[model samples]
Target: MTLSDTNHAATLALRALAWTLGEPARAERFLALTGLSPDVLRASAGDPSTLAAAIGFLESHEPDLVACADAIGATPQDLAEARRRLDA
Candidate 1:
């Protein structure tokens, strides 16, 4: 479940965020749940906090987590570990 095949965890988190936000509905849902505005997302996409939030967004729901993991060619655990590392 390592992210050895991908970029660093922070980068992977951003990739997951982009995947979650690719659909307007999904993006809107993420914003609603996380209280993050598009401006803020754009501004802090590189921050550890933002990356952690994005991974948390994916981790909150099984369907989204699995889908995001698959989309990014990673396992769900990898994303979770990535989040933990970023937060630490």
Candidate 2:
């Protein structure tokens, strides 16, 4: 991907991550599901794998994916595309 595309993907991933952590229950669930400790999450916030994992978590549940997309001013497709780019 181009640098701009990569940047956009990164931004979307970060936003998705924020949305995931915005609620205590969701955050706890995310941590449990991903097996990522808070320290690891914080330390690797900018890592592509971490970012992709965040989006992946959202993608795993359609309701959450759609809800998060709405909350973050993005479409679910946008988030999926972002995840693809991050994976690439």
Candidate 3:
């Protein structure tokens, strides 16, 4: 997945969400930071706003952003750009 792909933003956000949820503590932190309950998160997983929030969550923390980007085969900038696209 190249950053330029039209669907890249949503895809990357989903992957980031999965990575965020891979660990219980991190997932709890994400939910806390985003004010999203697990049920709401599941229900809105695909919503553009929710996706953007996921990207925003990563963006707010450099370590997680870099780690998630590396884990997902994307650059930190790619994640940032994806957030921009999603926000658009």
Candidate 4:
């Protein structure tokens, strides 16, 4: 992804994580790591990086975060399957 896209992703991921896990501590740490403010996170709806960083952070703390590879409760294998489908 482009630099802007990466930043945008980072923004969205955080929002999803904040909403999904209801973990403000994780979200705040992600914001700090990515140099994003609360306003920016609110503005970007679904940037991959935002989601990615949040997941990444959570994964470090709790590997089960891998279970959410898909947007709607997809497992890690499901994510691989989705990728396979996309690449086909």
Candidate 5:
């Protein structure tokens, strides 16, 4: 992805993470699916790797990905691409 695209993805992923955490149940589900705890999430939420993992987690489940993308005003593909860039 281009640098601009990657930057957009990162921003979208952070928004997606916020959307996920907006609801208690959704945050719990994310934590469970990602094998992350509240403590870890708090500690790493700002880190690129953790942000990428959150996007990757959403991407792994299409329904969640679509929902999250919609909620964050981003395309699912952008979130996925952001994960790839962050992972790299």
Candidate 6:
């Protein structure tokens, strides 16, 4: 996948995680650490900073954050296919 696709996927993953964890604050904090904004957590939805912020947040949260990550892990390929459909 292209960088943009990866970034978008990451954003979607982040959103899925936040939803599962029920901790928007954690998600927001994660984005903030990477100097990212929470608004962009949507798929292909936000700026690079937002993605970076989320990564930073997840890094800080560690094992506690794994639950959220795992929740979305199952859907990445499916998400990619959806993106492809959108592109087509």
lDDT of 3 by residue, 1-88 (tens): 3546638789988999999999899999999999999999999999879999998999898999999999999999988888888888
Sort the candidates on lDDT, descending order. 2, 3, 1, 5, 4, 6
lDDT tens digits, residue span 1-88, model 6: 6777665666664464455337766555555554534444454344444433444445454564455456666343444343343343
lDDT of 4 by residue, 1-88 (tens): 3555444444444434654446566556767776778888666535544555455554554444464444444455443333333223
Clashes of each: 0, 0, 0, 11, 0, 5
TM-score, ranked from best to worst? 2, 3, 1, 5, 4, 6
Better of 4 and 5 by lDDT: 5
Please state every model's RMSD to the true fold in angstroms: 3.2, 0.5, 2.7, 7.3, 1.8, 7.2
- Residues 1-88, candidate 2, lDDT per residue (tens digit)? 8999999999999999999999999999999999999999999999999999999999999999999999999999999999999999
The lDDT of model 6 is 0.48
lDDT of 4: 0.51
Which model, 4 or 6, shows the larger lDDT?
Answer: 4
Output the lDDT of residue 45, model 2. Answer: 96
Candidate with better TM-score, 4 vs 5: 5
The number of the candidate with the highest lDDT is 2
Q: Per-residue error at 42 for model 6, in Å? A: 9.9
Per-model TM-score, in order, reads: 0.90, 0.98, 0.92, 0.45, 0.84, 0.44
Cα-based lDDT at residue 50, candidate 3 = 93
Name the runs in model 1 displaced over 4 angstroms.
1-7
Give per-residue CA lDDT, model 1, range 1-88, as digits (tens): 3455334887789889999999999999999999999998899889888899989988888899999999999999989988988887
Best by TM-score: 2
Model 1 weakest lDDT span, ten residues long: 1-10
How far residue 5's Cα lies from its native spot in candidate 4, in Å, is 18
